[model samples]
Target: MQGSLSEDRRAQGEASAGLIRGELEKVREEGGSGAYGVFGEQRIAAALKRLGCGKEHGVYIGNGFYSVHTGVVCVSGYVTKDELTSEVHGAYAEPQPGTGPCVENRGGH
Candidate 1:
């Protein structure tokens, strides 16, 4: 039962990652115009890498937000779609407290 649950979560995370990747590609192809344009694809890519969701890593999306979690850090944010432009907007990274290295090491001997 536990194994199945973990598998299910992994599958769900993969699906969400695919969706986020597709959206990101669309924004990049469109020259990063709109809300997504502000941060630009490169910046997003860097954040994703830091969060362990770069091209070589996996992403996790939950409740309409995309996130990447490394052992020492996590970054989560939303990718709003622009109805008019059919592009992604408002893509921002929200730092997860207590997940970063500093937080994890706090008060540790």
Candidate 2:
């Protein structure tokens, strides 16, 4: 069961990252928020949650979904921690000023 869960989490992470990369690319090309609206933040948060570990990750996922009403987006596996951190930080920066630059701790326990 533990192994399966780990696999599931890994798959979820990959899927989330993929969606995020595609959306981000489109956002870059279009030079705007695209269809995500305020919810774009949620999508990003979801992707991070899939990869991260902790109760804080759950909080982030909840806020992210609430924030990104558009749809679930993913981050690609190729994305480095730095890139992911920057993207997540940028998404929630303005609306979540109290959150600060949200970076993935990686060593979630």
Best by TM-score: 1
Q: Go through the candidates in order and give each one's C-alpha lDDT.
A: 0.40, 0.33
The whole-model C-alpha lDDT of candidate 1 against the native structure comes to 0.40
For candidate 1, the per-residue lDDT at 55 reads 34
Instruction: Candidate 1: list runs displaced more than 4 Å.
Output: 1-5, 32-38, 41-95, 98-109
Model 1: per-residue Cα lDDT over 1-109, one tens digit each? 0112255555554555555466554544565445543434454565455434653333443323445543223334554344211111212233233332111222323
Query: Over the stretch 1-109, how does candidate 2's per-residue lDDT look in tens digits?
Result: 0112245555654555455565434433443332433235544454444545223333333222322211222121222222222121112222333322232333323
